[model samples]
Target: MTLALVTDDMTTGVLKTTDGERKSRTKLYWKRRREALSAVALERLADLGIEFPVVAGTMTIPEVCDYFSISRSTLTNIARQYYEELIEAGYMPGSVTQPTRYSELALAHVAMILRPSTSDQAMIIQKALGIYRAPRGAVKVHNQSGAHVKVCGRVLDEAYKLVSEIREDDPEEVWKALEKRNRHELQVLTVALAALVPNDRGGLRAWLAEIGLGIHSDAQNKAAVGLASLVPSRQQVSE
Candidate 1:
């Protein structure tokens, strides 16, 4: 009878593990997995000059996956398991009920758990988060030659008008919209402009100067003028 019972248990493939034991093992696995993924993701961010701790934007699930190059299922698992802690860290905490939203600081905390204090990457990111402050003056300096003029008056007003016509969206949104223009469109525009202008080299050079595309050197200007002579004028094409 005992032999028959052992065979039945073997056939059923049942193991004698308590719920607590299973929970503990699963929690341990999650911890190790989170640490490994965080190490890889943080390294990539560091290489890209982005420290996660100080990054300001909140990210949706898709954005996070794209930014970190992590699989959606893995992120779902991590976020689900740590939902409460994420909520404490300012995440909305409805991953199971609604879309999961994550902030940079929350992601930093996820890495901090079970991660060694001696990790240089982690230390650097944390240090920047803790002590870094925005500068009061200009963060970037541009080198200007004698030809460059500061934007003001009518020039500034025209620039503002141009920007509003291009995009009334936020700066990043405007950049994203501009990024949709491919190289082919630029080539087509260049060819069309070159064709429309009259075939006179001096006239082409003058037009180029007016449009702020004046060739820097006499040699380059000569080359541009020569190329213009080769392209048929709009009147020539009509004939």
Candidate 2:
């Protein structure tokens, strides 16, 4: 065997570094290559209908490879090399043992660009937006107002009490006494209260609306027109 083939200059089996270097072995300057797809590679991915978003809970890297007829190693190389750009492009991280999922935006873009069926396209967009269909029979709502309605017993009892208490034959005296207490302000308040039907019983308001005499009875609203008419109009006062 030749002497050069068997020997290292340092005698430690490594060639000594030159130019006043301290190392007995030569240093390696790593050649860094950006881990991004070239234009051709990107075009290929697009042609394969692969989108770029990292939709959560969607397919894994292996699944993606399967769908696109690609190998895992190729995808892994892209990920390992161009991780930053991938993230900026909305790639997401994988959890536990799963591979990364594409984002909603990515899924939707792929679906759109691939010209899938209308329903499938909608589904893809929904998936990308993280929207899910409500499961059948998840919600059952009942109309409570239509059921179990009895005439208000308390209101009836109160009315009975009011009737029993009003034994006086002269209601004018009572009316005068009430008006004197608040000087007609009480009448205004009572009118306002009467105009507003707070109970959702669909009784008075519903009936009025059905009869073409809704609470907003006229163009200015029935309540305003009616209330205003109760006071003499400007034309009437001028006359």
Candidate 3:
């Protein structure tokens, strides 16, 4: 009687493990189709918010098998089931394959949800993956030959300092406080402009003369009308 009971226990154990064994083989069946997954399909996975490389589309079988941890011949047999669809999706690229992407219908048919690619998708993915870069310095300088333009940063700080000595926003008020002979705002603007380019006095004089600034052009800082060498090219970048 004891021998009979041991035989029954062995039979029960095999029955219980059979389901898990079949499931393992099923997973392996799908995993071996290496050529099935394509770059575009991977992008599609990102779009779909699918976890990892796993996807259900005709072209996504390799990914699905991978997710299931299936390998070897079992993966090959499962892959054969979607073999035709994979070829149609251009996964099996050959001589005549003109490099095509998977179709929407095919992608949707398989279980992968296809999401639209947005302009911010790249940033979103980076954020999702916890990737970031440190911010850069804010100071910017633009050179247009001798017309050196220091944008924002130090320029704004200096402008505000000069302006605070007189009025906040009104150039006329600033001039009045300084007691200039000519109340013209342009004259004041030119003087204020001079402060920006302490390094390029010649360029300042040339620019001032053209606008009838009437400020004596320093013989020591002469600049040609056709030449403004201190100014930076628009294409050049400085931080």
Candidate 4:
């Protein structure tokens, strides 16, 4: 009687294991069906050539993958295969190291891929171009109490325009023209013009001249004297 019971228990366990396998197979089938649908959607998007977008004024490979929820390997393969197809026909810039570093050629490539409107393309190009730098400096004045005061800030945009105009002409010519102006007049003009020009030693000199101040001639002379003094002292050492 005990042996008969043991055999019955073994048969029941085997039946349960068979049922579990059937359920697992059904789940796998549904999972595969969903993956197939997702793959179809991705392919449809690829057919429409909707992979790339402008990022930081450049077209990047990773940005496209992230936007589409696609694997890197799959995207890379797709890019390699359809790269010329997209370029020759679709007008996309393909991919680069970073979107921010997109060159003019790259922008042209993107234009083909995206088929942007002429105006839209122009805007994108504008955004990608380098921005102009603004000028900045410190202002100093002596108060009635004989205290020296200084204020530092960016020059006004209008002042920058004047500086830009001045740069278009010769620097020495601009200085010689301003030489006859009084200190107060020079100060106002120099500060206004400096705001527009690129920062450099020449620009600094131009700025000083605009303000009725010349380059530190006394400092240069003093340095020359000091060097001459050192030469005699050095000769004494050698003797």
lDDT of each: 0.50, 0.42, 0.39, 0.41
At residue 182, what lDDT does model 3 achieve? 45
lDDT, residue 191, candidate 3: 54
What stretches of model 4 exceed 4 Å from their correct place? 1-53, 56-58, 89-239
Q: How accurate locally is residue 169 in candidate 3, as Cα lDDT from 0 to 100? A: 42
Q: What is candidate 4's local distance difference test score? A: 0.41
Q: How many clashes (backbone N, Cα, C below 3 Å) per candidate?
A: 0, 10, 17, 13
TM-score of 1: 0.27
**Candidate 3's residue-wise lDDT over 67-175, tens digit each?**
3333323334423566565555444332454422334333322222111121123334333333322225522222344434443344456556764643334544544
Rank order (by lDDT, best first): 1, 2, 4, 3
Alpha-carbon deviation at 122 in model 4, angstroms: 27
Error of 2 at 28 (Å): 25
Worst-scoring 10-residue span by lDDT in model 3: 110-119
Kindly indicate the candidate among 2 and 4 with the higher lDDT: 2
lDDT of 1 by residue, 70-137 (tens): 55764566677677766666565554667666776566654444122323344454443342223355
Candidate 2 whole-model C-alpha lDDT, 0 to 1: 0.42
